[model samples]
Target: MTHDLPYNGSASLDALLDAAVDAIIISDDEGTIVQFNSAAERLFGYAAADIIGQNLTTLMPPPDRNQHGQYMSRYLNSGQPAIIGIGREVTGLHASGRTVPVHLSVGEIKSGGRERFVGILRDLSEQKKYEAAVITLESQLAHADRLVALGELTAGMAHEINQPLTAIAAFSDAGARLIDNDNDAARTELKNICGRISQQARRAGDVIARLRRLSQKGELSKSSHDLQRLVQSALQLFDHEVRRSNAAIATHFNHRTKLVPVDEIQIQQVLVNLIKNSLDALAESATEPAQVHVHVEEEDEHLYIIVEDNGPGVDPENEPHLFEPFFTTKDHGVGLGLSICRNIAVAHGGNLRYKRSERGGARFTLSLPLTYIG
Candidate 1:
């Protein structure tokens, strides 16, 4: 049923359809292809002569092709549409047997006692490929970031484990002396020594676990996690080192219990790196009553994980390179702590940046997008 439909006063309707960017296809009430534009010809690799008068489902994949007729029948019978105004993402079959991702929108037209449905399809193959490439790039950057952090972590772990090993050695000597003495208090001393050894061993193991988390390689595992809990755990892991450095710590929570969806392990590494950098700054500075403060607050629909130090702030000259890869002021890392943290932050659709603390020290802020919780 070809109509002499007019477009403006000059352009023919066929010319307009052929000029359109999106593929346009018209089907009758019975779901037979009535018309196919040049764009549709290019999109599905089908000629208008071959496509018209055929079942419209020929362009759809298996299940959609099977169910489309029934859906159209239901729509016609009920005068209701399953998907009309809004578009849907579906797989379309090309004439060359290739499956393409497309966004499809359908519009209904009632003219001269006839009902016609028009479909506009947008090819999403390029978009899908681009997204895949971005994901792969992010994964690679994360792996490299972790590896750089691991280099610095190695020194920290060695220095960290030495204390626990020394304690373990002392406890072993104490247990042996208690056994040799064989006094009534010997039993209590032996139990205490055994407990001390277990504690020390666990301390060393904890360092290894934290380091492994950052250094492990794989696809990102993103999920909803409690920010407060992560902060607490990171601080707890550094408890002994903080105490050894005689640094006082304080924390403020929002009480709103902000939960964020992210790669928790990677984020935890970020927090640890920030804290470690702060500790390094504190150890090198002459600030009295060294203090490290962590605050978790929400502002502007963002969750901010902030680590601030009262130690000397970042050097004015090195500010720009602070987040640069392989830029380190220390003997251990390639300065990957800040770089990786920023990478993780960006990948999570958030940000990690450094600011000047009121105490004239470096403040690292990790801001994450807040999710809507129902």
Candidate 2:
């Protein structure tokens, strides 16, 4: 049921304007303020008496203040509107000499052979503060996820470092046994042994450096990096896990792929999570000749990093919850890996998606925009 309320003309309109929660100001065609309501007075810390005859630009900061008159002229002369009918986020000047974030919408009115513009502005300071807080919390959660993944890879990383150290020890022993020989052949063998030792030492250092990088917690910093090289680095970090699972790892990369802008450590974390999940699935299925295929390709203005494995695919019922926080299939899993991975992808203006592979296994794709501003 509906009932009509009695209209009281200008008196009712005046009451409505003052009752509004947002600031509402009316200005003439010459940009001089004509109406300033109670809400506007409270919002700008100026009484209607003081601001009634002032220019509407008094509420705007520098650039906007200086250009507003021109904008008004252009719109009036050419019928080309910028903010007259549309709403936009802009900076506003406060009476306290501070800048405030606000969303402003303007409408035009012609009355009694005169033109007037009404502006409705809502403060956005609280909204912006909330958005910033959410970003910070997400970053902290991503850092925690990285630390958990590193903990799980501790054994594999130890084995990786030990291989080079063992080789160096054997090379050193060979050099020591040949130290007493004076023949040219013995000298040549010793030189070769010393060279091998140096190579092994450098290899060990590289492993340690990779571990250090993954474990470090810092702000998200973006730079141009080769996607192919980043994928290889992630694979290297999982070398021991691959061997332990006896999984066959294969990579297909487009040589023409160009460098992309991303936070290297964060992207690597996503890659590591996908690869680790595939190997774990393969191990569980005990599939004959297990295989994990990683493919990098560029298409439709986006870059895709796909990881698929020939193992038991995810159950159809659980697919929807795979990326939800605290949702897991493994008995001892915390269920934050995929959640964090997806968050990291979205933060970069990209996304992570999952589907069944042609090889009858789970396939996960991380898609990123090639021209991402971040």
Candidate 3:
């Protein structure tokens, strides 16, 4: 079983290394570069003759450049592995003084009792650029979706603000009338009217504030928020629609773990979309005494916000295309809501799923992990 290849000579090995598509570098135990293949020379902007015999650390960026020797020493002395066989993405120092993204794998070689190490590197700059571009596109899409949703809710938002404004106007008129009486009883009544006006003004301000927050276009910012409160806020946006459609809304919240880390605006957008969809479905079905229930529960280190309606559910054939972009069941729908919602959920290290409800209706569950990694 001791068969040796005819291409074992230095010249043949050099030719094989040069022919490889990925850059290959071989260094002695002391971290001195001994063999710099042509691919490596092209990747690092250094000629093989210039890089050979130099310290391997010369090719690394600072931080890594300063610590690579220590890493090698630690592995050689302790026989422990950090990234010897395990490959990972890292930054490479190019001769042009620019940092390049690369995936690197290292292996050890022992020949005639001397230890050497071989490193293989693949450029990851294009992959990173593509990923960043994708993130930008998703952000833009989510923002556009939010604006569309807000546009649809314009009527409800106007109704919400109008109620408080109407009350404030009535209270203000009564206060003006009492100003002419000047009696003790009239003065007391005037104070009560003034308080009512202030309260109504605050109520109107709150409605406007909620609308402003949801309609805002910006980057995804994560923070701790009460899930139940977020759901309630979203429901407020549909008050007029729910009343007009004669729909009954119910909610159950688990207060024990209601707080979660998420981009509040985006999460609220998801809630708004789901609740609106449920309301729309109920409206279309004309189900007797339409009912929509929202429940928040915590199980197995995950938080779930479930929205279900007692209306016509999705057809079996349409289930598979629910999350596809530009697919819709509505006559005037652009169909990006579910797709964007699912992307937001996944971006937060969670998920969105649909299922048949116990009451024979459509049910959507948004699950978010309690421990957020982002």
Candidate 4:
């Protein structure tokens, strides 16, 4: 016998449930599928005739299928529930044998003196991909902001280092001329001047290299590279920035010989963001002798890099939304750096995240797969 829904409020609720984009399914306590909506049929590649009255376990994969009954029985008997009345992520078996990721909300319902469990399932594959894309866009913006900050600081740094370089250059030329005249005393003095010139030139070159790395924007280039070497190369690129900010740096490398295939430029971009953020955090602290540490470790199939700073740490209030686009703790920050770092990591089949460091500062960790080796 068919029973009509209650006329006023109940009818509207039924209509809303049926119209939802998510698929809805109702099953009896015996594990038989009783009601399947149009969306459920379309999503699972199954017709109502094929599913109705069939065992609900057919739509769940191996372990989940076997565990389903136990879970339902436990919930019913103990009144202690796991997924009931709560939204959860689950894998749904499709008729094509592929598993689809879904968000499910399950609730017990009573209709016409009968009890049933209704599940509302929403597909999450598309939404998850879109979220990843948005993260990438935010990361790019953060890198851009960093470049802008570096540009603003470049002129002062250049002037500060140039004076000694220019003086050394001039004095070294005069010293060389004296050496040409063949006077022993003058030649000795000239040699000292030459030594000073060589030192200063190397110093200037190091500074220029750091600036180039920070400001350079280039296309990603993929290659098989040693993880340790890549970390060192990125460190060299930011050496001057670290020193200029008075941040003491340290490193702990776990893999001296592991190799991975990745986009070198993109990975470097992520490293730069991490290092720069650490430096910025340390620079703001009132404490003396600011410090930052970078650690690289490789596990069976993943390379993990952690960059940490010793500072006041991220504001506790902002932790939940730290990786979100347009979120920043610094007054001058545009909030894109970490976001972009996350994107680059994800593109390389990894992830970037933030947490409290043992040193009491914010720590950023990058976890990327060792997808290539040789």
Candidate 5:
């Protein structure tokens, strides 16, 4: 790359300085502009001829404009320069009175017993806009990740709520028929039916409550929660869905109860997401006697919650990009469930990992610091 420069010719030097993309401005030791190229004109929104004889400070905003001369005098007196031979980001004042972010590089030239300074500035206005655009995009992706979880849970949640609703309807009909009879046997039956109705009402509320907790938008409030209960909560939330999907769920807790310091809801979200993915894989593969196994075990100081399914395993090729934002092999929306799950685990000082289950299916393990035993 160094050998490619046309270092021996004056024409090459002129072309390199004038035709180059970066704006170059040369000023005399007195801080008066001496040379301004075409690129400088395009960048500063000024004509070269109009700016050549003016003070270099004219191109700077008030604070820098007023202080640049002092800095130059200090450099000349002490041979200590602040910006010369140093490149950094600074503000540039355009002829249109607009401030632009710029990358600035300064160099000195000594010729014919006179001193000059050359400044190279790269405009960053568009780059700033691009950065803002990317920030907005990432914010949208985060929101989309949460919405996707809700979408996946909607089907199972519908089934969960309807089960209790159907029970309440049946009990109501039976209670109504008994009330009209007004006999001792009928009254006793009515009382039993009322209790069943209350139980179903609470069950329905539990389903809605699960959805509400997961949908809440707020910062994570972490505490020491029982790991076993947390896993059970996720299973209970998906109980009706498992039955509806013609899948079986088996849970094993070797470390029956361990208190882990983490955001309970966030960890629950990860487990639920893993379960949903497992169910989807099972459905697609049409696996006979579809099964999802969730096991909790404590190895040394770490507690592991493993969700494994008897379905199609992950493709070796897609494993690398699985956790990347918006990278999906599916025919639907952005693939962010696993990515978000991993983020949640990491934020809790834990890890979420994937591997091949013994049953030849995808296995996800979420491990946390086992803080206490209860």
Candidate 6:
């Protein structure tokens, strides 16, 4: 039976090996191709007839191909294995000259006192391409959200600068009238008005500078900053939006401490989104006092900022989908704010989440990495 087994056994084994999803290859003691399965041909973009007798090095790239012969020789002479019976990630050269990433497990087999190596390969090309596509889509969505935020900001910004601009023009006219009247008291009052005019001009300049910086979408510049200061800065960004929606703001920060290490502008962007969401939620509420509360706390190795509103909370069914891109409950919302906020939080090695507030409203919390303090 042992002598008769060789004829049919080989055919059955080859058929079974061909059925596997992963590629299988067997090489002779001299590292020449001995057997190639159907999956191997499909994965390498080559026909079995084309590679059956070729050197195994044909599957490797430049440096790896050069080293493979020496590695095999050393293993054969010393009886010490380098990759046998172990799985490893390596690059493979496809017939199309493309390099493919693969996880390979090789085993050494002995037959008629000669050595052979069988390799099982699992390709990563499809998985890698899917991951790249997801990342690209996310980036495009974030960009769209920023454009929507800019549109809303433009309206608020007009209001923010108009008040100061009007004050400057009125002050300049009064100063000119006082100069013509030639009265000392009126002239002094006019000088004071001129000073106020200059102050307002400077405030408008500051607002413009902030807007310009936010519009550029600069690369993240990280540093240690005061969390309290960050919150105050972000409030300025949303000043007009909150006022137009009639949302009242309350803040709760631990006065004793305020410090963290992070990208200041990015964190401020997160705050602006959270505050805007709060204002939107409050606008939809029928409550007498539309309130938004911002709280910041520092706990071991992390800083937490919570923005809560006394507004209509999210639907229970929509809770899981809140952070998803292009998901929104508002008519004018582009649905990118929360998603961008979460992306910024994750990029900062932190997290963002939404929950029900104690006051029966929506609460968005941003947790950030803190500098390690001894």
Per-candidate TM vs. native? 0.47, 0.46, 0.46, 0.43, 0.43, 0.47
**Candidate 4 to truth, TM:** 0.43
lDDT of all predictions:
0.82, 0.83, 0.84, 0.76, 0.81, 0.80
- For model 5, the stretches where C-alpha displacement exceeds 4 angstroms are 1-16, 28-31, 62-89, 98-101, 107-117, 125-162, 180-192, 217-374
Which digits, one per residue and each the tens of the lDDT, describe model 2 over residues 1-374?
Answer: 00021122276677888999999888889888877778788778888878877898899999999999999999999998898778899898888978888999999988777788889989887897776567557656876776577567677888998999999999898889899998999999999998899999999999877764554344568889999999999887665456446898999996465799889999999998898899889989978889999999888888999999999989999999999866989876777689878877887889999999999899999998888665
Model 6's alpha-carbon lDDT is 0.80
Q: Give one digit per residue, the lDDT tens place, for model 6 in 129-176.
A: 666567557646876776777778888889889989999999998887
Error of 5 at 78 (Å): 9.5
Candidate 2: residue 292 lDDT (0-100): 93
| lDDT digits (tens) for residues 49-83 of candidate 1 | 88887888899889999999899989889978788
Question: Among these predicted structures, which one has the highest TM-score?
Answer: 1
Error of 5 at 101 (Å): 4.3
Give per-residue CA lDDT, model 3, range 121-169, as digits (tens). 9988888777656755765687677657756777788899899999999
Q: Of models 4 and 6, which has the larger TM-score?
A: 6
Which pairs clash in model 2?
none
Write the residue-wise lDDT of candidate 5 on 1-374 in tens digits: 01122123265555677887999887878888776777888889988767777898988997899999998999888988799888888888999998778999999988767778889999987887676567557646966776676578877898999999999999998887778896899988888899999999999999988765564435667888888888898777664466458899999999854677878888888998899889878988988889999998888788889999989989989888777756776666457678878877776767899888998899999988766322
RMSD, candidate 2, Å: 22.1
lDDT comparing candidate 3 with the true structure:
0.84
Give the worst 10-residue stretch by lDDT in candidate 3: 1-10
Lowest-sum lDDT 10-residue window in model 6: 1-10
* Over 4 Å off, model 6: 1-9, 28-30, 45-50, 61-63, 70-91, 94-103, 107-116, 149-158, 212-374
CA lDDT for candidate 2 = 0.83
